[model samples]
Target: MSIRAVDLFCGAGGLTYGLQEAGIDVRAGFDIESECRHPYTENNSDVDFVEGDLSDDVSNAEIEEYLSAGEDDYTLIAGCAPCQPYSTMSNGNKNRTEDHEKWGLMDEFAEIVADIQPDLVTMENVPQVQKHDPYDDFCRRLAEAGYHISDRVVDCPNYGVPQQRKRMVLLASKHGRIELQDPTHDPDEVTVESEFSKHNFCELEAGETSDDDFLHNARGLSDTNKKRIRHSQPGGTWKDWPEELLLKCHKKDSGRKYIAPYGRMEWNKPAPTITTQFYNYGSGRFGHPEEDRAISVREGATLQTFPSDYSFVQSEEELSVKSVGKLIGNAVPVRLAEAIGQSLIQHIRNEDPQTQLQTV
Candidate 1:
């Protein structure tokens, strides 16, 4: 029997890569946009990429056409619906709009599961999404459908991604009970230095591209921020700055007077959260530890924990570091995806990689 999955809202194949690496035969990806097709299909030849508006007019018949015809296909349906609504940082109350998450994509997923009756199911999304009623309702619907559902919020670094990112993850299965993976790394117990020191990063330049696009890709800081970072120390905050460099906003009482703003990353600790504008040091403590520039495309990718050798295919003329940088920073780190995939695979079948590696 083949292990099968369908990645919904697949963005540039991050989760697709991880699941494939773990021997899951992801059949095809469904997305609303056409851009995702190129990188997703090009890199993941073993999988198909289907483009469509999954939240609208998409039907159970459309989803069933891809599932097993007769044999025990061990079907898995998975998606991370567009989560702009739940993010605390979204520009406005965009989550209020209809036809997106508002139309209940999770409910749509549940409806599909009930119809096709896949053996396993999963979803990954921003941590804020867990606070919404829809997520709880979706889980309830899954339980009513005779599936063992498990859900929880997780910190990405715990799964070996270098950045500090939290996510909501859920796994449901008809095969048996479902469970989320345990933390791979501890915060109080695991420092940032301990995460990447073992890897052979010495040959890697301070700012360079990795085969895997998600490693590190902070935008080059502006000249002004560059000058500021040149003087900034790792693990230190704005107080360390001289009076000449203080922004007028900080001089005002309303300024956030916090160390994270315009701060450099400390090598000994996990990176601050990887935000959409993570490339810009001004957004948070995203400045490079020893260099004058902001985090490079590769460094940000590293912070995301995509393996150094993982390939992100782009045309020669298309390496606009900025565009790819956003893709990587905004992407689910492939390793985090790997951990999720591996966890789900093990949970569904008692197939722990650690134990398998020991035997091999």
Candidate 2:
């Protein structure tokens, strides 16, 4: 029998699409955002989408009704709970006790697994999560529940993602111990220049995309910013900026430490981790290697390992660059997810049904 899966917090179906690519039967996806419905359904036509708040309790009835669309196959429940609360990037808001609701969602995910007793479970999140109490508690609870688990923090470039994103992945099974797939490619093998060339994207100027693809078109820059980028060198920081073009903040002692913003990406290196505002040159090291504009939406998606045809918007009216950037940046890289799926399949195939049933 084929393994079947459901993705919780399934933003734009990155994990779902990837598991499907690895031959897992992904029957449904659940997320709080309604915007996810179209992209998740459109890309995986056979998959159902359920929208609801993950911060609240997800009852057994709701899980069975909305997510359990498959039959008596080996079941997998996968989720990447929102990482913003645990992310170092959002540490400024660390004191906000009320907003910790997002962190509580992971406990809810654990509760669901305890109730449903799925054959397998998986979770992906920022590496910083391991330092906190919640992550440690989740692991302890799962171990106590009789699940054999393995987890490690991994660099995305090792898994064939063309960006320098590091994440912690957990793979647990009631049947037996399982671990994620090893690196398929070294960091140098999947550099930005090499990956772009593979997809037919050559050197581009301001606001230009390949003639064959409009999605590759970059966000246009203002005259001042265009001049700033022209002076910026690939892999260079804000110090390279002319005195007049430099921001007053960059002149301050504290600001000199923060050079990632308004920096240009190197063609020969993996891109800096793609973020929700990646289309804006002012956000992190998102500037094009040589072009006088930020990386395009399609470029961000490609770096996230999303396929060429993965649709983010339906029409021009719906195409807000910031909104699309958030969806792509927040996704688990598709290639990394595929590697996890393949490992899970191997683990399941190796298990003896008689021994697996004893865990339940």
Candidate 3:
């Protein structure tokens, strides 16, 4: 049987593109952000990009239509609901209560899975998601629908993503037991230098853009910050700076342990988690190892394992560092998604010997 899929909450088609790379026919992707349409449709031409809020009944119905388009297809519904409410980064924030609005998106995803009863389903989210009641509810509903469920937190570097991202992945199949594939890469073998060196990006100074690659543009840095990065050693913290360069906040005991800000990444290790603010030098450990600026938009996407040539916008005028960074940082690392796709295909083939699935 042919395998057909729909990706919900598909931001810039990262998951959809990865599944497609593994030979799944991902027919459609739905997201609320219209900004995603260009990248999603431009890259994955075969997949229809539907811009809408997935919480609406009409959206769910539209998803159902995509799944049913091919009668002989083995249907799959996959999604990674917006994870801010369940992310560890948001854990200690005072405004977490206000973030509850997104807590229901997972429930909406579950409702669709329960109603559609697709042959296979998968979801990827921050590891903290397991602690929430919505996660338990989502799993319970899948079990009630007769799915064989398996889930665990996975390190992205083990799957060849050049970042230190840990995500919770869940796989559910109606066709007997299913699980993610074992790590395909040795974490040590997937390093920042190994990946970024391959790109050989044109040398760019702070606030400069590559003439050849538009996305390879670095955010501007203040003069003080420039001197700070000049003194910053790879994998070294702000504590390494001279006394005068230290910020008042860093001088305090409370901020002593917070070493990620203004730190440069180590060449031999995976990069720190790519947050939406990665383009800003002061955000986390986002500064380049030798360059006097934060990682460029293209570099951030590379760390997320997006193909080097993946287009984020149609033209240079449309590019916004903040917007593009959010899309790239929030994306499911494409390599990790491809691994999930492989496992699902293998599970289907194992259950039905007559099925033939291909991978790119």
- The lDDT for every candidate, in the order shown, is 0.69, 0.82, 0.90
lDDT by residue for model 1 over 28-47, one digit each (tens)? Answer: 88877666777688767577
Give candidate 1 regions above 4 Å deviation: 57-59, 91-103, 186-218, 350-360
Regions of model 2 farther than 4 Å from truth: 55-58, 65-72, 202-214, 353-360
Identify the superior model by lDDT, candidate 2 or candidate 3. 3
- Against the true structure, whose lDDT is highest? 3
Candidate achieving higher lDDT, 1 or 3: 3
- Ten contiguous residues minimizing lDDT sum, candidate 1: 351-360
Model 1 / residue 108 / CA error / Å: 3.3
After superposition of all CA atoms, the RMSD between model 2 and the true structure is: 3.3
Q: Candidate 2 on 1-360: residue-level lDDT in tens?
A: 567778999999999888888888777788988788888898875888888875464555666554454354678889899898888877767675336668787887888888777888999999988887778888888888899999999998899998888999999999877888778888788888877776766566766756666567787778888878888889888788789998888889978888888789998999999888888888889998877788888888999999887888786567777778888989989999999888888787677644332111
What C-alpha lDDT, on a 0 to 100 scale, does residue 161 get in candidate 3? 92
Q: Which residue pairs of candidate 2 clash? A: none
Superior by TM-score: candidate 1 or candidate 3: 3
> For candidate 1, what is the TM-score?
0.83
TM-scores, one per candidate: 0.83, 0.92, 0.97
